[model samples]
Target: MQSTRNKLIDLLANNQDKYISGQHLSEELNISRSAIWKHMKELEKDGYEIEARQRRGYRIISFPNKLSENTLKWGLETDWLGNTIIHKTSTTSTQHIAHHLAREGAKHGTIVIADEQTGGKGRMNRPWHSSKNQGIWTSLILRPEISPHQAPQLTLLTATVLADVIYKETNIRPYIKWPNDILIENKKLSGILTEMQAEQDRIQYIIIGIGMNVNQTIHELPDDLSEKATSLRIETGHQLDMIKLVQAILEQFERTYETYLNEGFKSIKTKWESYGFKIGERINVKTMNQQWEATFSGIAPDGGLLVENKHNGKVEKLYSAEIDWFRE
Candidate 1:
C-alpha cells in the first residue's frame, strides 16, 4: 500500500517535464486541494524544491541529497525491489531489522536501509564499519521459489550487480572475490551477506544484506581498515550521490534476478566469472583438513569455488574454505 505522499511524489516525479495541476493531483490522490498544498509544504520541508504557479500546479525542481524513503523512491525505477522501503536514521543493523520484518511476514522486496548502523556485521560476524551518510547499508527481503541449495547463487549474483554498477558509475572495474566480497585494485569496496530461513525442503525467506563504502574518506575509515578497505570517494577522488547509487543497485538487481530465475544460474556464472578476482591465479585454499595451493578456475553450477589443483591435474569445487587471496 503506497502512502498518499509517496503517490503524490510518484505523480509529480513521473511528470517531471510538465506540471501537474492541483485539481489533477487532488483527484488522483483523493485529497482536497488544501491537503495537497499541505503535502507540498511537507515535501518542501524535506528539502524538495517544488515550483508552483497560479495556473500551473507543481513540479519538483530538485530533490534532497538525503537518504529517506521518499527521496529514495522519488527517482527509483524499479517495479517491486524497493516498493516497500523501511529507512532508519540510525539502527543497530539493517540485517537485524530485515530479519524481524521478514519474520512478521513483510512482503518480498521489502528493503531495510539505514544512514548509519551501530553494529553492522558482514559474513562470519565480522564487524563492518558503516559510517553515517557515507555509505549504503541495506538489506533486501526476497521470497524466491528456489530451493535452499540454490541460495548461494544469489550472493554471487549480487556481487556481479555491485561490480557492474561500480563500473558503470565510475568507470572503474571491480573484482568479485569468491564468496561475497567486491574488490577494486586488491582493496575491499563492498560486501554481500545472504541469510536464509528455511524448512527441510522449502525456503521461508532470504535476506541479502549489502554494505557499500561510497563517500568515505581516508580519515573516516578506522585505522585498522585503512590498508585493506577503500571507498568510492577514495578511489574516484569525488563525492558520489548515494541515492542515485542505491537506485542503480536496486534496478540492476531486480533485472538480473528476474533473468536468473527465468534462465537459471548459467548466465550468472558466466557474468560472475568475468569479474572474478584472481581467476586462473594461484591462491592458498584452506579447508578443514589441510591448506593447499590451487589455481582459481571458475564457479561450479552450485556456486562453489572451482579451483584446479596444481599437482593433481584435476579441478575441484570447494564449498567452504579460507582463501588467501594475497598469497603468491
Candidate 2:
C-alpha cells in the first residue's frame, strides 16, 4: 500500500511545474476521482503542500525536496548506481532509513536522501555537519554477495570512485585519506561511510552514505569547520552544475563497484593505492593504545591498513584505529 501510494505521489510530483488536470490523472492512473482526492488528502497529511484550483485542477506547490528525485533519476546515464531514490525532508539518518528499507525488501541500487538530517551521525557517532540545502547528503543501498569479512575493502573502493568522479568532472584532483575521505590538498571535500548487514557467511546489504559539499562557500560552514571543510565550488572557484556532478559520481561509482564485484579487488586496490594517502611514505599514526611511526605500505586484502615499521623492520597490519596521518 505504501508503494502504491508513493507511486501516485511521484506521478504528481514529476509533473509539478505545471498543473495536472484531475481528469487526465484519473485516466492515466486508472482510478476514480474520489480515490484521487483521498490520495491527495493523504499526501497533504504526509507533509506535501499541494495547491488545487477550480479550473487549474491540482498543482504541487512544494515537494519536501528530500532524496532529490530529479538529480537521482537524471544521474543514471550509467548502468545501476541510483536506480531507485527514497527521500525525506528531515530524518534521524539516511543510513538508518536505508537500512530499514533494505530489510523491508528494497531493491539494489536504491538511494536514500535527505534535505536536512536532524540526527545526522558520522564516524564513531559524531555529529555530521550537514547544513540544509547546502550539501549532498545521501546513502546508497547495495546488496553485494560477498563475505562479511570482505566488507571494509568496499569503503576504499567507494572512496576511489568519488575522487575519480570529482577530478574527472570538476578537475579538482582530490586525494584520498586512507579509507574514505576525499581531500583537496589538505582540506576535506567529501566523506564516505559504509555500514554492512550480513550473516556469518553471506552478505545481506551495505548502506554507503556519501556527504559531498557542493555549492557551499566558506561562509556556509560554521566558524570551526570553515578552515577544515570545503566545497567543489570553493575549490574550483565556480558554481558547478549539481545535477551533472551527481550523475558523474553515480556513474563512476557504478562502474567501479561492478568491477570490484566481478573481478577481484585488484583493480580497485591498485587504483586506491595510487590515490591513497601516504603511499610509500613514512607517516605517523596513533592507535588507541600508543603512537608510532611507520612507512605506509598499502591496504591488505581484508581492508586492514598495512604499515611497515622502519625502526624495527617489522610489518604491522592494523584492523581498526584512529588514524591521524601526518601531513608534512
Please report the candidate that would top TM-score against the real structure: 1
Which one wins on lDDT?
Answer: 1
List ranges where model 2 is wrong by over 4 Å. 1-67
**What TM-score does structure 2 among the candidates reach?**
0.79
lDDT of 2 at 186: 75
In model 1, the Cα lDDT at residue 98 comes to: 97
Q: Which stretches of candidate 1 lie over 4 Å from their true place?
A: 1-3, 10-24, 50-61, 326-328
RMSD to the true structure for each prediction, in A, is 2.5, 4.7
lDDT of 1 at 16: 89
TM-score to true structure, per model: 0.92, 0.79
Record all residue pairs in model 1 with backbone atoms less than 3 Å apart, i.e. clashing: none
Model 2 weakest 10-residue run by lDDT: 66-75
> Model 2's lDDT to the true fold?
0.79
What are the lDDT scores of the predictions, listed in order? 0.93, 0.79
- TM-score of the candidate numbered 1? 0.92
